[model samples]
Target chain A: MIHNLPPGLIMILGALLLPLLGQRLSAWGALVLSSLSLFAFWTTPDFHTVTLNLFGQDLSIVRIDRWSWIFGLVFHLAAITASIYALHVKDTKQHVAGMIYAGSAIAACCAGDLITLFVCWELTAVSSVFLIWANGTETAYRSGMRYLIIQVTSGVLLLSGAIIHFQQTGSLVFENFLGLEPGQRGAISDLGFGPLLILIAFGIKGAFPLLHNWLQDSYPNGTATGTVFLSAFTTKLAIYSLARGFAGLEELIWIGCAMTLFPIVFAVIENDLRRVLAYSLNNQLGFMVVGIGIGTELALNGTAAHAFCHIIYKSLLFMSMGAVLVRVGTTKATELGGLHKSMPFTTVFCMIGGGAIAGFPLLSGFVSKSMIISAAGHEQMFAVWIVLLIASAGVMEHSGIKIPFFAFFAHDSGKRVKEAPWNMLTAMAIASFCCIAIGVYYQPLYDMLPFETHYEPYTAAHVIMQLQLLLFAALAFVFLMKANLYPAEIRSTNLDTDWVYRRLLPRLFAYIGKLVRLVDSLFRVACLAMIKRFLNWLSKSCSAQGWLGSTWSTSSMAFWAAVLLGVFLILYYL
Target chain B: MKTKDDNSKGGNSSSDASWLERNVNVVIAGLVIACIGSLIAQLWWAPLFAEKHVEASHVEASHDDGTHDETSHDEHAHGESSHDGASHLHPAEFAVEEVFGFEAMFGFAAFVAVVFLGTGLRLVIMRDEDYYDS
Candidate 1:
């Protein structure tokens, strides 16, 4: 244990120090320092807890454990890669904000207590919004606000749940609490609202089915590099927390399946490639969530390994898309075509990413994705196995082929653009290398899993079977393309399940508003008419309304008080 | 409001586009053949290229016993003996329940295929210079 040196505090201090130096140097410096810190503890023993005093109690801020390290390692890699990609960006606010955002996530992973996690969680929320605002567009501003509200609300749930958990369990350890002891469970349920609050907290960040609007709304609108970083840490952190807390919860399996399949439909018709990726990102998280729900040693390992591979491949895909957006001033598939001649390198990198995401044999996705598939078969979850298999094919269609095919290799749109910058290319190369390295040398990764198991990812039969699936999926794509049996991208919107909330709910509110206004106006008119009639009658009865609308006399007040007192006495007696 | 593409007159007009349209199939087929052929070749020549090694080979075999209930003391010790043939309802398999649904899954796959095919046809039907524009 170290004194006066928690990782969160160190990160907060670094965030303050960044803008003081030159923009490029400070951003690079922060990335290097954070990477070094991560390296320092990469192989540290699991379950290493470090404490700090907060509010007169000992609080654990650094929970060095297998899970935290798993997330921490990837977060650092993302930050470094993002930093390298953003070397040309001149926005100081975005740079500083990105560091703080990345730092808070790292700190959140290391946070051993609920309060510490909450602090870092909200910090990430506040800091990352600047990245969206840095886009300097009206769309980005609105989307940033939406992103902020949702994120802060998720943080609020965390705080509320932490309080309830503390009151019940009398401790605030941020580790697994899905299945508590009987005494704790009794206390938890007695609070009545504990699980509900915690679920909502994880739900928003986890992007659980219908609760996943903020992601599609904000991600595409985020600045190019901002989206790259956004792709990496935030949602994946929610997934990690879910795994830590809600594993083996059966409800999550169906949610995961829905997540995997639903997005591909929208992504296929979606004009914006970045938004397509957001949908694709949602689909990928479903797999991890499924693994967590399985909660077996193999399933959990699958979740972790998937997260690891997903980070690199997803970021690479994002980077490639970002390059297109930067050069062509758009990522709309309809508007993009045949840039493979000019941007050959970008195209190659994108194909690698697409293949990886599609779970093609020998790609990063295949090895990790199979774990979830096999887990389903092992459990005899016939429905789930079918869905996952369908999702695998959907991935091939949308991300696997559509992304690269439309942006780089359709009919030549005659747009001549230079390749991505040296730094950007370097970053892509590193990420692509990691993707292949992980795919090809999966044994080392399997060995590093928390579970003690011997799993063979490569065999003649397994490879042959995987090839059959992928080859057949590719054939499907070819047949579909040849036959014109796909949905065309239209200028109009394709409604998602979010339509119930985003469009339908708002329209409902407006309809209610109109009705309320109509009723209120009618009531006001009736009230005025009634008052006029009463006044007219009073005027006739009392001559110029002497006792009413005119000056009130002490006699009138006394008379009313006498009547009120008599009525009060009568009621009391009854 | 579909505009007629003047390029329907064929490749004689524009050198760049004609060159690409003429060679696109050849290039794509070449790439496909190359990627597959290389991967197949790697089976013998590229040991380091394969994603899995020997240790991971046994993981599927042992996964059943290793994942016996955490609450069941010595339950894992019984191994394959305790596992009944009929009821394979292990807790670890619960994760995919949310991840897989029949109608939704099949629907998404079919939808993606249709969308890709539709877009590709759209490109052919209403070819435009600025199809990539926002």
Candidate 2:
């Protein structure tokens, strides 16, 4: 019966009990719930729908299929690993918020209808903000608020899009929008405005191009352990939504292309190593998006597989950086270097993550990412293929080279710190093992994909070509570094698109406030002057010294009354 | 060997220096050899596998159904060819995949372009940490 419950509810309900439990018990409970969810995911029959009748409309609260199953599995895995990483954290609120956040993402993944999905979607936005707040810094608080507003806006769009779609189609069963037929001219032209709104909603969460600043802004500012959880879920869930709703939509190819290319530039010069990884995370998502855009069996398989591997490795990267943040009190590349000497285990783990992300010959990225690139080549998308190739090298530069090189192996910053805690190292080790296991023996991963593909990743040609690209990219890094052409990390903030909201709008509001205050004071001054003049006239004419205020008031009153009466008589006669 | 106490004192111990300091040449040499070996293998061995894979994939495509058969013998045979020049033959495939050494060049060029362009953008957008504070 417990297994029969919606998988996400187990975590959500379990989170409610977290505060009452001891710290150790809460951590263990979080892991247990996540593992139970994974078990539920496996046992739940494919395409099995659990429906409830509400207001004469059927709502599918849980739908287990290969697509949702993959996402559910990864979400649980993220929850477990992130929970393990955060085991040392004294903050119970973060544990509760994290569990709830992970639960909401899993719920959204399994929801069979748009309404259920919308509810879970908003829940994710509401719950995840606490992770940001857990940092207890003023900057974190502000960033968390901005993150909430954007996430809620995304949920609103999803709700509106769902309503309009249901009205038009007379159904709310969640599936790919019928208008998103393969090889369509454009998503907007084909689906009209309704699905476009939904797409933009996912795009905002997905960190698509200009809608991406929320990720870079808030992710780094979360509590050290909190960011590992933050890194895994939100964008990946959005990717799942896009895969579910808009696969094979050709426009996504270009959008995904842009996503891959733009982040590299920002990540290159970013001083905060966590922010660099955040940008790297964006670049990684691009490959999945492109796969969804292509929408072939192989491409979809690539997307699912890449998402799985990316969750582990990206979190591992985050975990290592988090360890650095915990021990050294900073994650800035400008401040961190030669950390590997003190934190050798973390160094090895970071390298594994970096290698996995860079698509080295025996890593998860090689097995997964090549599928998307190969899919592009097979589709004759030469332009996208070229951009992807370039982005691959770009990935090597930032995630592969810059992250480890700067944090652990570059100039010795001379700040010796203890190795990461056992729990953190253990979590990183598990993730590192996964990165290698999935890379070398990929059959298990392939079996779990949404589609059956016989695509072989480790071809002699593929391996050699990938090696050539990665090694050559490495060479370029060395050349640049030796020549001093590489950008030096500095303690500064780079203005991103968030500047529009965080800086420009607030300053504009302040300027308007000043103008309004000036006008208000002027109006007050004029009104006071008129009152003063009126008082002066009163004193001059009607005060004790004036004629009206003199002792002859009775005679004047009589005279005025007589004159008024005479005038009234004359007018009446006329 | 340095004791744990020495590490905890947060002194600028020489041990904190990167592994690259002592082994930079060996690492660089090893990487160079790996790159050259990849180039050699790509030219010498990969083409033969590529041809076999192309032919094998062609056969598989003819009998292709929607469902993937994991135990299919031909699929395993095709797996040896690597990722490039596989069965989902499109007319306008990447020309670089057919040529040897082009990927390395392209990768190097891409790295340069990305770094150069990124550096240019940095000049425009880079600001002090308190840019928003004022």
Candidate 3:
């Protein structure tokens, strides 16, 4: 029975009991529930499907396979770490949100049918917003509302796509929509209307470029520890779904490249360190999208590996930023500097995350990102390879140096606060450890990939090229700083795609409303003028001075009437 | 650049700057050396790349003989491998990747270009801290 239980249901159902433990023990309760669920998930047999017969249709409510297993395991790890991160938060709502959010994401990845995936997708959307709203500020409330609308809209699209797919194909099984197998390539032409909508749904959730502003708008607004939970699940869930459903779509390559390139520039000028990380997260997803587009065994492995490592290091990065937010009360680069003096441990963890993300030799990024770049190189995609190279240096600039330098070192703002709370430190340390361990020894991660591959990441050619790329990028930073060419960290709002909805769309509606009111007032005045003219004529005629109102007018009226009668009689005689 | 001295006069427990703050030059020097070291490494590994290219077509096509093979290369691509003389993908596909200081130069140039672009972008997108609020 335990083996049959859905992998993430334990934590989802167990979240209700968390409040019973009271706020103090709820974090620990969350940790225990996730651990138990992980154990249950690990023991479930391969290719297992737990189904329910409802309305004469069999729904694969739970399925454990290679793809889902990797995601499931990582989701559990993230949940446990985030629970540790939030251990000190006495707010029961945050813990509940984190658990249900993490659980639904796990369940979403394991869902075997589109219907099951849709339910869990919406669940993740609904449950995760509380993490933002738990901040209990007006800005947080607004950002959370935006987040909820976009996410639920994506879920709605997913459901609508599934319904259409069911009507056309008579199957809701969540597999490749394009019917392409490993080593096969496909184009957007291969997709039907149903799958196309589903792809957009995935694209939105994955934060594909223009669809990405909700992430930057909402993630930074989440409460300190809450952002840690927010970082791990939702977007990665989209990556999993895309890999399962839309891998090998040709347009994804260009889309992924665009996704990778634009964000790094934005990250360069972003003030909020968390928002910078959010942009960095978007850039990393681009690499995975490119891999899925490649649609080869080795490329797929790279995607899986990159996702695993990214989850850990990203959580680590966010945890460090969260610690800064906790102590300094802001993550704005203009307001933060010299934090390492007081928070040495967080500084170290942040640097580790920075280095790993930069794809330093032996780090998790070097191991995983190289695979995708190499996959492109192997395909003889010279342009794609070169773009990936530029993006690597770009990653070095933002996550590697700018993040660590501005937040922890740079010029000291001299806010020497105490170290991060013990639980927070513990969580960051765990994530940091995972980053280093995976970088140095990656066979375990490789073993978890969906396919067998002898594709190596540590060849001398690969390492030297990667090192050359990152080191030179760092060298460039040093030169820029010495020359005072690096843009000074200024407190400013950087407008991105969110401006369309937040500013342009609202202003457009207001203008339309103003136009409607103007027309209404003009129309009312026109009608009133005509009415007043008629009334004026009636009032004048009624007065003694007007022809119809005067008593002598009766004689003239009788004469006119007689003339009319005589003309009528003449006409009748003729 | 605000020196460590400028920061020494703020808050409790920050009377003296840390070793890193006082030695910014050392970090720069270290980065330069590491960059040079990476360049030297490409030179050292150029010969290994040579041998890999000669045997790349067969070794990478289907199996690994343990001498740097990508065994999982797409089988479908084999039919189209007429030009590169290799059935599987290798790290050094283009002659540009094999240049001695190509990655180093590209990294430096790319970094500068992105930073400058970001500065230019700031002119267009950057706004007051309360731009949205007001």
Model 3 TM-score (B-chain only): 0.63
Clash count per candidate: 32, 1, 0
Model 1, residue A273: what's the lDDT? 88
lDDT of 2 by residue, B67-89 (tens): 32321223321122234444432
**Candidate 1 TM-score over all chains jointly:** 0.79
- In model 2, the runs with Cα more than 4 Å from the true position are A179-186, A516-574, B1-12, B15-19, B49-92
DockQ of each: 0.09, 0.30, 0.42
Cα lDDT of all candidates, in order? 0.71, 0.84, 0.87
CAPRI-style docking class of model 3 based on DockQ: acceptable
- Candidate 1, superposed: residue stretches over 4 Å from native: A1-11, A43-46, A180-192, A497-502, A537-574, B1-14, B17-21, B27-134
Judged by DockQ relative to the true structure, which candidate is superior, 1 or 3? 3
- Write down the worst ten-residue block by lDDT for model 2 chain B: B71-80
lDDT tens readout by residue for model 1, A281-346: 999999988877666666777788788889889999999999998888888876677788778899
DockQ of 2: 0.30
By DockQ, the best candidate is 3
Error (Å) of candidate 2 at residue A25 is: 2.5
User: Among the candidates, what TM-score does chain A have in each?
Assistant: 0.89, 0.90, 0.97
